[model samples]
Target: MEITIEDLPGHTKASLSGRFDTTGAIAIELPFNTLANERRALVIDLSNVTFMSSYGIRVLLRGGKIAMSKGAKLVIFCPDTAVSKVLTRAGTSDLIPVYPTLSAATAAVS
Candidate 1:
């Protein structure tokens, strides 16, 4: 997996590609947690992600909770159907809003 973070005016955008499995989750935990701890709105772009595991859901949940507690927003964008199904089945989609487009995701957090 690859994680690329970008700074937006009011928030941070993290673009993720490849599989979001245990290894991938571990790889991004530090950076992702750090960003969440910053207490700023966050946009996670999952358009390029091909797969998502339960571990990935856990990481996202943790980040979302931390961000929410700090009054920061966290939204996901463009997850592939497979990953989207995983999130929805895991009820993660309910906790973190997922948008079909980057514009929509950013708008929601903004």
Candidate 2:
């Protein structure tokens, strides 16, 4: 996976691309942790993520927990249909609201 993080006022947005499998999940751990520590809210843009595995879901859940513990929120935006299915089936969508648009995702935490 490739991650590009942008810091916005009161929140951060990370744009991710490629397959979000075990390797991809591993690659993002540190950056996610950093963002969780620094921001009041996070928005993960997954529009370019072609696939998502259980490991990927774990990464998101872990990050979300960390953010919550720090009094922050984590949201995901624009995941592909396949990735959305995995998140929904895993029940992660309920835990961390998934938005179909950037505006909606940003608004949720704003």
Candidate 3:
């Protein structure tokens, strides 16, 4: 997977692309962790993501736990493709809260 980090006004958004599996999840975890420290709410954009595995959802849940502990939120946007469906099938959507778009995710977090 390819992750592009963006420093938003009061949040950090990570735009993810490609497949996110156990192997790719390892590489992406570091960047995701670094971005988590940026703001109270961490936004993950999955619009460009093509696929995701349960391992991917596990990575996300870890970050989500960290954010929650810090009184921060982890919001996911563009859960339209297979990536998002994987999360949904993994039962992470209720745990992390998935939104339709970036704006909606940001707005909900704000």
Q: Which segments of model 2 are wrong by more than 4 Å?
A: none
Ranking 1 against 3 by lDDT, winner: 1
Q: How many pairs of residues collide in model 3?
A: 0
Residues forming the 10-long window of minimal summed lDDT in candidate 1: 78-87
The digit string of per-residue lDDT tens for model 3 on 30-74 reads 878766654687889888877788788888888888888888888
Instruction: Sort all candidates by TM-score, best to worst.
Output: 1, 2, 3
Query: How does candidate 2 score on lDDT?
Result: 0.88
- Model 1: per-residue lDDT, tens digit, 23-95? 9999998888888889488999999898899889889999998898898899999645888888888888888
- lDDT per model, in order? 0.88, 0.88, 0.82
Superposition error at 78 for model 2 (Å): 2.3
Candidate 1 residue pairs in clash (backbone atoms < 3 Å):
none
TM-score against native, each model = 0.94, 0.93, 0.90
Candidate 1 segments exceeding 4 Å error: none
TM-score comparison, 2 vs 3, better candidate: 2
Which consecutive 10 residues in model 3 have the weakest lDDT in total?
A: 33-42
